[model samples]
Target: MNIIALKSVDLAIIALYFVAVLAIGFYLKRFATSGQDFFLAGREMTAWVAGLSFLSANLGSLELLGWAGSAYQYGILAAHWYWIGAIPAMVFLGIVMMPFYYISKTHSVPGYLQLRFGNGASGLSAITFAVMTILMSGVNMYAMAVVMKVMLGWNIHFSIWVSSLTVGIYVAAGGLYSAIFNEVLQFFLIWFGALLIPVFGLIETGGWSGMVARIQSNFPGQDFTHLWSTLGNAQDNPMGMHWTGIVFGLGAVLSMGYWTTDFLVVQRVLSAKDIRSAKMAPIIGSFFKMAVPLIVILPGVLGLAVLPEKLVPESALQAGQHSYNEVLPLMLARYMGPGLLGLGVTALVAGFMAGMAGNVSAFATVWTYDIYRPYIRRQAADAHYVSMGRWCTVIGLFISIATAYVAMGFASIMDYVQALFSFFIAPLFGTVLLGMLWKRATGPGGFWGLLAGVGSSVAMFFWVKLNPGALAIIALSDHAKPLAEDMYRALWSCLINVIVTVVVSLATQPKPLSELKGLVMGVTDIPKEQNVPLLHKPAFWAAVSIAILAILQWIFW
Candidate 1:
């Protein structure tokens, strides 16, 4: 079952995929000569290219293997991460946020913060985000290594280094251009590799209704199919998460924070050809995001139907020591024969590489623009910064390699990542929300509020760690897990940020409206098309995306 034992055709397919990816990196290397070229692809990407990369950057191991495993462990409730968690926020970014992002001409999210708030907030964000991005990259690397060890029987350390080295070389060579191109390529490969699992799984399970009936029959009185049905209260759900936490914590805070402010995805949209393309990118991505649960989540549910005993042992139905993260690999091993199996493994590898590349690319951009250029070298040439970006990529990948070793101590890759996001992103979003919408938010207010929020999250995290019984705010029932704790922590941290920011802003002097032009909502007007058809408008497409999401919730409800 290991990759070493794969048939020649499958191994060939995997080899060819690596070659093609490397070829793309080398091919795009020439275009990455200047800072703008290296960081933003010279602002030349089409909507579809940016959109696919935007979606595919996130489609890495976390979205693929993590969510699939989540489906197995958490049931249909996992879809919330994709649907309510991603789609609306992506649409929000396209319709409401992209104009400011594009018009500001900022190379990174921290750069935007510098313009909207000041250097204090921007520098803190840049450093914090740079660290968080590398850590997340390590999460993907470790997760992929775990999958490889389980499926291919490769040495985990060997797998980690090989993947890390390959990603670092190419990303350093061609910068964000190579990352975006490969991300689009990985998007196709992921779909091709994963779509078959659910297709064959459905056929094996006797279709949608048949799978539901089989799961019920195999595990009597167990409810694993409905999305909202299991979420009435803390005790009602398998995840021990209440609707309030899920809707507000995940959907409102974490999702918005990640989608709107996290530079990893925003960098993709910022690379688009124009403002329209920037706005359209996430909207196009949202369409695909809405359907991703079918690819990632359904496999876990399918595992429940096909391999329930394996996924959840008799000793644990809701909680288990069994490795549920193997749901995607298990399903692939179950259905895919030689040639197809290689492609499947390649897809997984591609996802891992893409995730790592995306993080490192964002890290390089933020480091070069927000930190190195502004703080270290005040007037470096564009070519000099581009070289610095390349060097930063190398350094960032090394840091991620170190962080991957750190992640070895964690139990669930997804939970570890979520905890990190709660600590950094959730509070960052609180500051971003105010900076963008509330013109009165002062630079001092933004900086201190973000610091307070992150400190609060860290304090809460350690407090709960020292005293498990102290998680009353997060736990709906005694059965609540770390995942629930993360959601509640995000909720509290975000509230603290808002409260501190508003109080500080009220006490401090606000920047004049003239100084806030184009950055603040009331001070600036996003371009409006007077005569374009509704279908062509970004707002119209956002509405369509939300409507589709509503239908999905109802169907899954």
Candidate 2:
């Protein structure tokens, strides 16, 4: 409440950011004249550029604040999202899955589905992806406005309009080219702006040890500092989750679903210059992902140890009460002074805009290529589609702005939108995983299995919503929390998808082996990477990344 509005200097710094990103968009518009250029960044991005953009695409203000809030609520258990929920799947994407995606030469994930299954599966996947992107962009749009209202006391409507319009202008002008470059720039801004919180919070708390002692003293009988120590029993941890939920549900299903199959992040890898670059992009991203908990989760953990006033839940926030999600802004107001505060605000603003840009860019691609190309206007010229893609970006932003306003009325906006996204991801991953690895996975099998998988998830969601008592039955334990419920839901949906696909495939006529060329794994002639130098190879770096993950888990345990 005591935080001041942006000073003249801060306003100047933020203004420069808008000018810079707009400049990048306008400058690249000339280069992104073709469909390939606008949609895929001309497939010219080297590993490092693609890698940073891949990581930054998901580093939006909402992700940072929400996860930081998670740390405050659940403690070090939040790191599992960064580690178990991300690392292994990302490495698997780079090492195993990237080959199938890259070699098939599919424009989008749904495009890959179309080649492997048919129009039925592709249409289903594309439409769902388009809807998911719009909702997610709206979430990012709402997050930007929330940050502005919280820190500078700006009007929410003004914040939302300005952000959506700016993001729209750039992404519409240059498509993925604009989005990727801006995402890379935003990555640097985020680290510079947000890294200060953990640094100053540590100084106040003495260090990690002091913060641990303070949290332990504040919440007696709660296991808040250890990552895996109390995970054996659902009742032993603050998260109220067992290790099976962490390992099988989250680490296997949700992790693979989001990291490997979610098109938003995977689109960045699709822009890499070559196979090796595609393979290496996610590998590079894995290393930086390991460090994100330091900035995101640590700040919330620090807040639990040091904040003078307790924060409320999102629905409980009203009048003068601060929510857990407000911890970042509250900490900025507390420790940061003058110019640094401006940088922090700019970082959040950048994050929000870039998040919207990433979603809109991916939406434009899927809507134009996956949806419009095959269904609406099958005979359109490449230039016409490029024009349509540009138009789709602007249309998507308008929809996102509307969704942001709609989000204002909901108490559980995040949960509802996130559940919509989760409904498709785990099941879609199951379908794609089977289509790639199994020779017997027929077209009808993929379609019906995917629909049934998504249908079951939807059924389960409403069943729990209508009767809260059903959560204990579904999650397998009364001690399971809302987060744990999601993990179990994904695992169940994925399992159902795999089972249905197998059952249906056994009964249907199969596609001949001659027709399955680059699409299926066993039949595809994948080029070997053993000849590449060890330092340059993706497998070597992936191994090193796994080694680092193990060491961190052991230390945190």
Point out where model 1 deviates above 4 Å.
1-4, 312-322
CA shift of 274, model 2, Å: 0.4
lDDT of each: 0.88, 0.87
Model 1 lDDT-worst window of ten? 313-322
TM-score of each: 0.97, 0.98
Q: Model 2: how far is 1 from its true place, Å?
A: 4.5
The residue-by-residue lDDT of candidate 2 on 21-101, one tens digit each, is 999999999999898899999999999999999899988866777778778888889899999889999999999899999
Task: Tell me which residue pairs clash in candidate 2.
Answer: none
Residue range with the least summed lDDT across 10 consecutive positions in model 2: 409-418
lDDT of model 2, residue 376: 91
Candidate 1, residue 140: the lDDT equals 92
